[model samples]
Target: MFGIGIPELIVILVIALLIFGPNKLPEIAKSIGKAFADFKKAADDVKSSIEHEITKIEEEGKKTEVDATAPAKGAVEDKEIKK
Candidate 1:
């Protein structure tokens, strides 16, 4: 799935079988599956955390933009009244 196609996957599986033998293949596969699952969960957690931080930053930026423009908005009206 990670860009390795069917033939590459078959080759890898054959090598794993040769190295670990049939008796140990299931156990190894199970362990690999669990590790992959754990990795995916951790990645998702990190992504969510980063997304939450970005949202917080965006909210703060909007507030800053408003705060920055607020004084200028009033300054224009003050000068118009003087004229």
Candidate 2:
């Protein structure tokens, strides 16, 4: 994929084999595959979280604003005594 042809992949694999030795090639390949999979999963999780937050903000915007005259129950009555 990404314009990488079969010959290019073969050359890359051959180089890896030379560097890591045949015995460790499979292990290295497995690790690489796992890393890519984990990266993709993490990216998806971040994307989903961002989308959820955006939806919550949009829903909040859609809600009707509260009327100011409604005295909230817990407000303190601070009537000032004039001297």
Candidate 3:
């Protein structure tokens, strides 16, 4: 997948078969698959957590913006009522 063409892949597979034998191939494949799956799962979790924190920070920023305007709005209303 990493830019290795079919010919390259075939050669690598042949080498592996010779080194490890057919009997151990399936076992090795399974372990490699599991490791990649776990790594992907962990990466997704970290990405989601960072997104959640950013959303929380944005919501808090919105709340602060509204709060900041409230005092000025109240002051204007009070002045109009007095007039």
Candidate 4:
């Protein structure tokens, strides 16, 4: 799938069959599949974790912005009351 066409895939598979023989080929393919699955799972987990952290940071930034403005608003109200 990584840019290898059908002919290229066939050649690679033939070479693998010749080198590893039929008996071990399935086992090797199974292990490779599991490795790729594990890698994808890890990548997904990292992506989700980063997204969660970014969302948390954004929420905190919003909260801080609101908090920063609140005191100024209160001061303006106090000045209005004094006047």
Cα lDDT, all candidates: 0.94, 0.87, 0.93, 0.94
Candidate 3 lDDT trough over 10 residues, lowest sum:
71-80
What is every candidate's alpha-carbon RMSD to the true fold?
A: 3.6, 7.3, 2.5, 2.3
Assess the local accuracy of residue 3 in candidate 4 as a C-alpha lDDT between 0 and 100.
100
Q: Write one digit per residue (lDDT tens) for candidate 4, span 1-83.
A: 89999999999999999999999999999999999999999999999999999999999999999998776643566567787
The collision pairs in model 3 are: none
Please give the lDDT score at residue 24 for candidate 4. Answer: 100
Model 1 CA RMSD to the hidden true structure, in angstroms: 3.6
Models 1 onward score TM values of: 0.69, 0.74, 0.85, 0.86
lDDT of 3 by residue, 1-83 (tens): 89999999999999999999999999999999999999999999999999999999999999999998777643666667888
- Candidates, ranked, TM-score: 4, 3, 2, 1
- For 1-83, candidate 1 gives per-residue lDDT tens digits of 78999999999999999999999999999999999999999999999999999999999999999898776643666667888
Report how far residue 57 has shifted in candidate 2, in Å.
0.7
